[model samples]
Target chain A: MDKSTKCALCPQKAVVHLKYFNRKLCKQHFSELTQDRIRKNISKNELVDKNNRVAVAVSGGKDSTTLLYSLANFAEKFPIELVGITIDEGIEGYRSESLKVVEKNYKKLGIEYKILRYENEVGKPMDEIVKKDQRLPCSYCGVFRRDLLNKAALEVDADKIATGHNLDDEVQSILMNYIRGDFSRLARTGTKTAADTGFVQRIKPLSVVPEKEIALYAMLNNFEVYWGECPYSHEAFRSEIRDTLNRWEERSPGTKYQIYNGAENLKELLKGAIGGAILFECEICGTPSPSVICKSCEMKKEVR
Target chain B: MDKSTKCALCPQKAVVHLKYFNRKLCKQHFSELTQDRIRKNISKNELVDKNNRVAVAVSGGKDSTTLLYSLANFAEKFPIELVGITIDEGIEGYRSESLKVVEKNYKKLGIEYKILRYENEVGKPMDEIVKKDQRLPCSYCGVFRRDLLNKAALEVDADKIATGHNLDDEVQSILMNYIRGDFSRLARTGTKTAADTGFVQRIKPLSVVPEKEIALYAMLNNFEVYWGECPYSHEAFRSEIRDTLNRWEERSPGTKYQIYNGAENLKELLKGAIGGAILFECEICGTPSPSVICKSCEMKKEVR
Candidate 1:
């Protein structure tokens, strides 16, 4: 591999390139560019703080791996204390890959990893619950995932939890919410949320990164990923949103980028409209919410 | 054919049950259960009053035709005036059938009918404009249709513009709006609205009626209807919503109806969020809108 050639990771070649862990990447490293932008965005937007002991919501997916990797990189420079939190939903053939990648990355990066099992915590595997329940799979998974992530973050004594939600996902969600007119979800959605205040503040560092860039960065770094989709993803409405956004992106190449910028521009409008102060604690779990009981607690109680 | 048996047309056993008008309708009863239920819903909900002069927006489709037919029927019994308004979007190989149906229905029913040709009023047909502007045809068509409807409504001096939107359409739109997080649209959505100070209120008398019910009513009554779909509708994002909702509905009967009801429940919540307010006049067209310019004026500008 000729060093003079463009970095295999990112096509962009900047002059002040840095060699980290034998990877020849430009100063504008794909991961770094993404991570730095997200970090600065969150900080600038007043999302994260020095007092926060953040929980890394690791799923062992490429996005989560990149998040963990970048947070570790950021920690070397910043005084941020980070710990890994993984929730195993106990889906057959799915959780294993994510678990392996998450555990391996935590070990490799020397971060404390806490595995919260769904069956142990929620009293049943998501698959079993979904199979028996008449509710949509996504309805179950979303409620369970949120419940577990928040609970794990709280149990581990972390003030903030970081997840790897990307631009494509965010925009799709924005579009989906707009289409369905789901104002509550839209109002609640942001790069960071204090909704689960008693549990953990959730932040997305990769919120600005596009799907292509994340995939490229993951590939270049040879990050172990769970390539197959969740078997119970029949309820994933996001795929429709992804395709819709992708169509627009393809027709107008920079549309997705513009959407990210739009999100940034609309941040204040969204905050004002969505209102951050709507937070209250769930009566059942004492989790943060806009209502007396959080959605997850409501769902869990209903399911039971 | 079988008088004692259920009438294929009416699907109801009433004294007025007969295959009147050659459609094999069970009877020429003043109130078919669904139509009566719909009218009673409109009446009980106080959707319309004797003081109102309503413009029935017709597209020559089954739903709209059924709406107009029922509205005409209502006019006969109740002290109400009815006018039909059609906006011609100028799509090739389409609209002709619907236009014919509209004309035939109006002529037979002796109802006043007005046609707003897009070429004359909006200065361009949808297909031609879409080709030049690279915008989705339905996006442009929807705006034009709405603008024209309001324009024609105002032209006819009608208090309320009645649309043929049914349960499925409402559910799909609610879902789409929720998915897109557009609370504004969801806020103003329903069978009826207050004559919210600055705008002409729109009403959907067929609000409780399902699409199939409308189609059956149209077929049984021999109400002429355009069976073909809009040429540009394939590009619509709502189709995906429709598909998703359709599958959900099939999985659970009356699920779509419940979703519509859920949307109704959220109407107040949506209004308090963004996209609140009813139609205000378009500064350009002097038509009703919550936005500065009406959607039609916006689309016309976009195409021009």
Candidate 2:
């Protein structure tokens, strides 16, 4: 409630107050703390090794943009090469604006970038795909985006692909899998990186950071970021879960952290029970999939 | 929405419409369906065995009353014996009325009944327990009730102890344990019956049935059930989860069942990963416990 409180670590005026940890910080200290937390997460999870080429999936949103900036900052200390990859889902007004923001950040940072389009890969843009059969846009978008990310990462010869999945996104995903009774997805929710044949290991450096904190970090650091909802983001069930978690976090501070941390612990205990995802080649596309054909190829065929 | 629709299985006018399954059923068919579901659950899970004496934990609430009546009907076919066990937490205006209902049902069914009081076992009532500590009444109540139930069942020489936990309660518990980051509790949630040294195996016949259906079944069966809530039923967090699940169920029917069924499936898949509850004699009471002393004994010592 007090906007002009002093920073906990220094004498400078506080710029951000974290309710979960019950701390207020000045601009300089807040940025440092944000980077430090991501650094610790990377080291704790062994997310990167010496001379590792990392591909970051940037969507121009606060989470991805913050992740890219933080990881680039982290690169100054660690021996890692960073590359930016963006998927244009072909949502008219949304994708174009976000792409501009992504391009600005990558250009300013002097990082190499690649843009993948849904139309090029799947033969249909999301806008057209939804027009044909609009039952679950997320399902189609998720499968396609994931397939393209992996493909682009492999093409770029990257060892690991990084995503801007923050604590809120991670917890929402964990709760969603639990609610949907999808055990395989639930089991893999806690891992920092996942590996399969022909699929680069995926890393989430910002998985521990809260979304609000990421947005605040972007604002404090003056990162060019676009904070717009995707036009095709109509996940009603996910929205319900997000609202439930937000309410819980409001009532009990650090609930999001607890859910994420608890999931990690459970995953460890159940590791033997929930083995790693089974890898098989998709008959149609030769992509890594549990079944004969990957989800993307199946959807692509259906959409066509 | 149509109140006068005919039963899906029969030509009789519908008495209840199940939104989840999207079917209307006559009173006779609804009752049959309810009982048949429980019967199949018991058989599928092997909740009861022939010639086994089972102790039903009755709190005089609709769930317990309905459970007792249903189990009584079930016993007519199976060769198992039934007895009722009630714990009087000493909540004034609440326990007394519920005890009358328990007594009435036990008398009508000719089932043996036993009453255990907190004052007798723990040397104080729930009211006094809360008056002293005044935090987490549910925690204290749960520990005390579970301990008393196990002790009473053992004393009555019953092989299994049955509780009135419905679908809502089961799913709430699964989600709550998950949110709390309690992996140990989450691992033990889906077992139909938990076995421990000197502890009776516990069974939940109504675990698959929803709360609303349980209430309706009690009404149709004309069981003089007490619908009063416990005076100490102020679980704020649980209430939040209940409301969240209720809203989701309203928006998408079968959400509760999906959570429960999914948990069961996951538990089966993770059985090897999550082994049975660790068993050891409690240092204070010689009861089965994973630690030096059991949770109930630990709480009793603190309460005293």
Candidate 3:
């Protein structure tokens, strides 16, 4: 271990060695740097405005837990209100334990919180839905989760919906869209916020931070972090891409950040090339969707 | 061996099984399909036009060998002239043998041929340049090769330069540029031709066909295919991406085509996003370039 190397700023023994930036940081400095990076991402993207009510999607995982904690800290400087929203996807052994972490953190932070369930909104739990249609549990879960997050944000009268999508997730998504030949999705990957009114503008504050660093920050801060995998989370394609990217990242230390930056530059360069999102009210649920009926409504019908 | 499955197009025993399309084709039909696909790509992208002279870049590999044959056949129907240009990069064992194959094919096809040497143009061969700067042999080789191709094409007065960049090469480049965050290169990947005057437009006739299919097609056509790898061809990152994509393609058929189609869609969608290329006369060489000095001229100075 290179523990003898002093921190970049102080004389403390460094705990974390960042290969990308070639900086050795101690525990205190590392945590401070992580938070500072998130603050910079938020400000650079204009994710939060003064007097804005933001709904943060907290899954009690390391990423969201870290994001919520960082945002709360940020609230001390900016005039912004944050509300915590957690979705109980009805996974028995998985979600219940993670929800406890969210509850504990929200209560301690003195933030208003809301817990929504799939059974309450979608008329069926994921456990039951997977039994009927065993093809795409992830597809069903994603559609419903996104729908609920938008609805929950609107219910709170929030101006923005924040998610714990760190750099790894964002870059993986960019690669996934490119591999799947989904050009529209590829074009829309790294935009700071959506421009539609019916949909709450989604902001990813941790988009610049790597997942490992977020986990480290969460551990350093003593937040309750759930390391459980979702029981219904099986995207084989995504897993393959993640493994490939992780291998590449291992080989080249700063690959994830390069991909993230490349994505942002591409998005900026092609802003006009990718046309505006033409959203319409879903006929059945009145949600905003490109098609006549939203994906959530279509999946709900199948589940029922 | 699945010898029991009959050919989908003919009564003869099937020699090739295309997993992507789930079709078994005999030798005769497979060759026909390969050529037809190339023809479709050419017509769809408007790669060739009437009364246009095309400089076909042939390296005596399976792809270029197959492309030359296809273009010779295509010229019979379309009122276009074909000329073959080979770049002898001065690789001792490699270029000398490949040039023989090009000579044989062009003579048999009745197409005019031209060969240029790097030592003559750049004042030094790649073999010697790699000794001095051992880091990026591929980069130096690429810059010189591209510059030579453009100059040779101009000498032949060809309206467009046709390259044998099959689906695998094109998709690999798309993923590479995306990974490296090279949006400009990504946006320019599959374009049939450039709009600049001094720069000859490039057309990739074999962009839709897979590499394996091209090799098979070359074998069926009895073309003298050079199976040697370039001595200086060591792109570790590209090799990794190629392996990953091949594994994905093996597990999921048609992944390459999807990636190719997706790249095309992305290029079209991001046309306005990636601004127009600004071309200025190079200070050292009067070539159209974005910078004051062209890449070839800069590289030539170093190589010399």
Best by DockQ: 3
lDDT of 2 at B111: 96
Model 2: reference contacts kept, as a fraction: 0.89
Off by over 4 Å in 1: A1-33, A87-103, A115-152, A165-190, A195-197, A208-213, A224-304, B1-33, B86-104, B112-148, B168-190, B197-199, B226-255, B272-304
Over the stretch B30-99, how does candidate 2's per-residue lDDT look in tens digits? 9999999899989999998899999999988888988898899999999999988999998878887788
Worst 10 residues of 1 chain A by lDDT: A14-23
Per residue, candidate 3 scores C-alpha lDDT tens digits across B97-204 of 888888998999989988899989888877788888855899889888999999999999999999999888988988888889997887665747555546889999
Enumerate the candidates' DockQ scores in order.
Answer: 0.07, 0.70, 0.75
Provide TM-scores for the models.
Answer: 0.68, 0.94, 0.95
iRMSD of prediction 1: 6.4
lDDT tens readout by residue for model 2, A1-304: 6555999999999988889888899999998888989999999999999999999999999889988988898999989999999999989999988999999999999999899999899998989999999568888999899999988898888998999998998999999888888867766655465554447888899998888888899998888999888887788877888898999999999999999988787677666666676778899889878899888999999887
lDDT of 1 at B129: 88
Cα error, candidate 1, residue A228 (Å): 7.1
In CAPRI terms, model 2 is classed as medium
Q: Chain B TM-score of model 2, please? A: 0.94
lDDT of 2 at A161: 90
- The residue-by-residue lDDT of candidate 1 on B1-304, one tens digit each, is 4545555555575433322222334445433666886888789778788968999999888888888888888888888899899988888778866788789889998999789998898888776787897766676776777767877888899999999999888887776555444555566667886566455689998888777767777776777788998777754456655776666555446666666765675565434445445556679878667787877777777777
Candidates sorted by lDDT, descending order? Answer: 2, 3, 1
Native interface contact recovery, all models: 0.02, 0.89, 0.89
